[model samples]
Target: MAFGSVVERNVQRPLMRLISMGGAPILQQLHLEERLLRRTSDNWCIVNDGTAPPTIVMGVSGKVSELVEVEPVLRDNVPVVRRFSGGGTVIVDQGTVFVTFICNKTAVTGLQPFPRDIMSWTGQLYDYAFSHRKFGGNAQSITKDRWVHHTSFLWDYDVKNMNYLKNPKRAPEYRLARNHTDFLCRMNEYMPSRSVFTEGLIAALSEHFTIQQTGPETALSHDNDFEPSTKLLSPQDLQDIISSKESSTVQRVPGWPQS
Candidate 1:
């Protein structure tokens, strides 16, 4: 079916809650919690900017053995987290931004299933954001399920820079950090700032979904009544998570992955 027809069927299905988070680790935790909640409630959507503290997160399908130099990351006090969703491993820092959509299967229509339609709708959202920019790349939808749509953006990224950070021996199985290719900007030469792209994306998605724009909020904080999962990793537990991948190969640490 055409993308628009599929989206229309799903748009009015229900009120899907969207939550934008601060960093990668917190995003991972929230995604897990939302998935658990979906087992009972099943009607909320969440979007998060999983950037900050500059860490590398591997998707469920991503092999930690293939993604990073784990030992160095641990030594540097960086946390390597695994997300519940299936996608390639991603290096998230202050620069990377993330968006997640969560909802129930009944909320989808026209499309054969929830996953398919979510991917289609998400593609349209990215198209709207990129259309306004001179340089833009495509949005890659990883997996489709009744619960969530997982995707990432390749902003002005440098292939050499990523290689230096992850030190992938061969070209990455997924797209490597191509200097010019960007999901939200054109050619990566003269791109808009990360804030500009994020604002544009939020505006487009709000209009497309016919939902009001809600500002950012903390997912699990002491100030908020909502309690974080006790299952959350403590500092030592996080270290164990990193150390558990003892078999993963290691590479020399570059001066700074960002610069």
Candidate 2:
């Protein structure tokens, strides 16, 4: 769509769906964001899971073989999900807070639908929520005139889970050759509570975007209208993919974390 047309449509559409995301398959979470970007015209900002079972998620452009130690990941019985966004691999488990903001290019003042611009805006926004430590990672996925830019703020994480990810051939510049534990910082170090921080964030974001609280029931309700070509990859699907790889790849897979 042309820029003018997109802006015009966005002008008429002002509601930003704030969906609560939790306890679902991490791959399913990724696919929902993909669907929202491609299939719907509504603005959405997802405040996702605070914690669930451990899972290792890789960016879409991230090569599974390069970023993951398949054996350790599988042996650990953790689901390895490849997201549709471009970002470094990370392990999601108890205490990881996921925040996503999807909007039209013109939705926010001085904001462009482009990647770098959105990322920059998000960094500032994150700073407002987490002013003490810099946000560890941010990602962008653009479609037509709308884009999804999200960040993961770890509250607390296990050092052992970081071992599932191998040193990537390509990594975020901030990583600076540091391993996972060294690279990311927990949000808990700064914020007293997840609810306190996220609630404050929602209020802060409302200043820039016309957001409205919506239950998860309204999630993908518009999806009956448009569906993407790519199917959501399940844990079993990823496990099979890893199992078929070379023996060397399988050796790195970690045993399932003891419950």
Candidate 3:
């Protein structure tokens, strides 16, 4: 389905709460997605300029041993976080930009709440927003009534950070076995500045929603009482995964081997 049709099908454009969490910590940004998806019924679109510190974020079903170079990350004390969403593992720093959409199943009239459809819908949106730019990666977490679609755009990157992630056992055919440096491109090379890119994204988004501006905290219903399941893993946690040698039940992203 086309991106425009996702919204045009509805007689009234759905209200989307927009928040920009500039340079928030990866874990907190992740927790917010869970809160917005589970506690609230309204649609949301969150943008993060970058993560506070360098961190490796994995999907719910991601295997740290397979996707990350665990020893160096553990030795350097780099935070390793597993999000509630399902996607490939990514190591992000101040150079990465994040855009996430959390919506009710009813938000889009006929769009199916499946990963591929949501991704296709977003792909078209980006194509309209910045036709020349490329995305870092995207993943989706869908439930009976809601779904969150998030993507990373590499504004700039530190080569050293790429050392933290290993080549996936299965990768997209387009990768062609290129090393991290060759596989990823910096958005700054294409756009003048982060601000300019963001402005364009907002403009594209305006085509779909009324674009209500909101504080990230306003979306939370029980800030103090709620505990997040997605967290930055500790030394013992990594050790346990290493020791067990068991596989994960969570499904891998497309292009990744199922087993």
Candidate 4:
């Protein structure tokens, strides 16, 4: 088969590989690096086992008011950061395993735009990971940006637990409190643990793509070398960071019809 044909056969198909990643902040930074890498390399893929220290990450469009319980989260010393991609806010603990695919948009082969081909592709990967289990996974468009497909594996996703965290009545300033309430309440109950899902995704991607399991040594080499531009936040700095972006517009990816 031709190269393109081979890649097309692999799209949404299963592949297995081993990957390890550091804490949540490091993984978030790596996501930024992968975004930059898409501008250059083709054929490269990344699967990160981002099982990290406890942290809360808000999506690019997520309202801080909605995405975090500031007083408690801060008191717990868990860092809250924003990702370049738009999606639902998520909490990453040691139990969560994060992964990402880094390849040139031109090398994406059979997948088309947004929800259709991309969603199918991810669904296949999830299927391979959760193989005989009751866990569930899904994909959605968060933005027009290429190079990354944003997803999460819910290990023990409980409606009551999610509701306790996302209660609208708890925050009057939240914009889509009602929407969040409905979304969490209606979520599936079969969420699997991060490790199980990560293992499955790696296997699926390795079978389908040209898989390369990376270590911290390899991952660090790809790091963006920006200096310590900002100081470790003092209480005032934290307040400023929150205030500066409070009124900013949250970017959203255009949704497409299913394939």
Superior by TM-score: candidate 1 or candidate 4: 4
Provide the TM-score for each candidate, comma-separated.
0.58, 0.79, 0.85, 0.59
Number of the predicted model whose TM-score against the real structure is largest: 3
Q: Which stretches of model 2 miss by more than 4 angstroms? A: 1-13, 128-135, 225-259
Looking at candidate 3, the ten consecutive residues that score lowest on lDDT are 250-259
The digit string of per-residue lDDT tens for model 2 on 57-98 reads 777777777777766666556676667777777778767778
| TM match of model 4 to true structure | 0.59
Candidate 1: RMSD to truth: 7.6
Tell me which residue pairs clash in candidate 3: none
Q: Which stretches of candidate 1 lie over 4 Å from their true place?
A: 1-13, 21-50, 114-117, 127-145, 156-191, 212-259
Q: How well is each residue in 1-259 modelled by candidate 1, as lDDT tens digits?
A: 0122223433453455556565646455444444434343434444455466665566555555556655556456665565555555555554445566655445544444444455566666554233433222112222244565655555534343343245334443333444323322422334446566566665655443555434334333323444332232234543444546553343323443321
Better of 1 and 3 by lDDT: 3
Name the top lDDT candidate.
Answer: 3
RMSD of 2: 6.6
lDDT of 4 by residue, 102-153 (tens): 4444445566656557656666555313222322222232224455554544
Of 2 and 3, the candidate ranking higher by TM-score? 3
Task: State each model's C-alpha RMSD to the native.
Answer: 7.6, 6.6, 7.5, 11.1
- lDDT (CA) per prediction: 0.47, 0.68, 0.79, 0.45
Segments in model 3 whose C-alpha atoms lie over 4 Å from true places: 1-11, 127-134, 222-224, 240-259
In model 4, the worst 10-residue window by lDDT is: 250-259
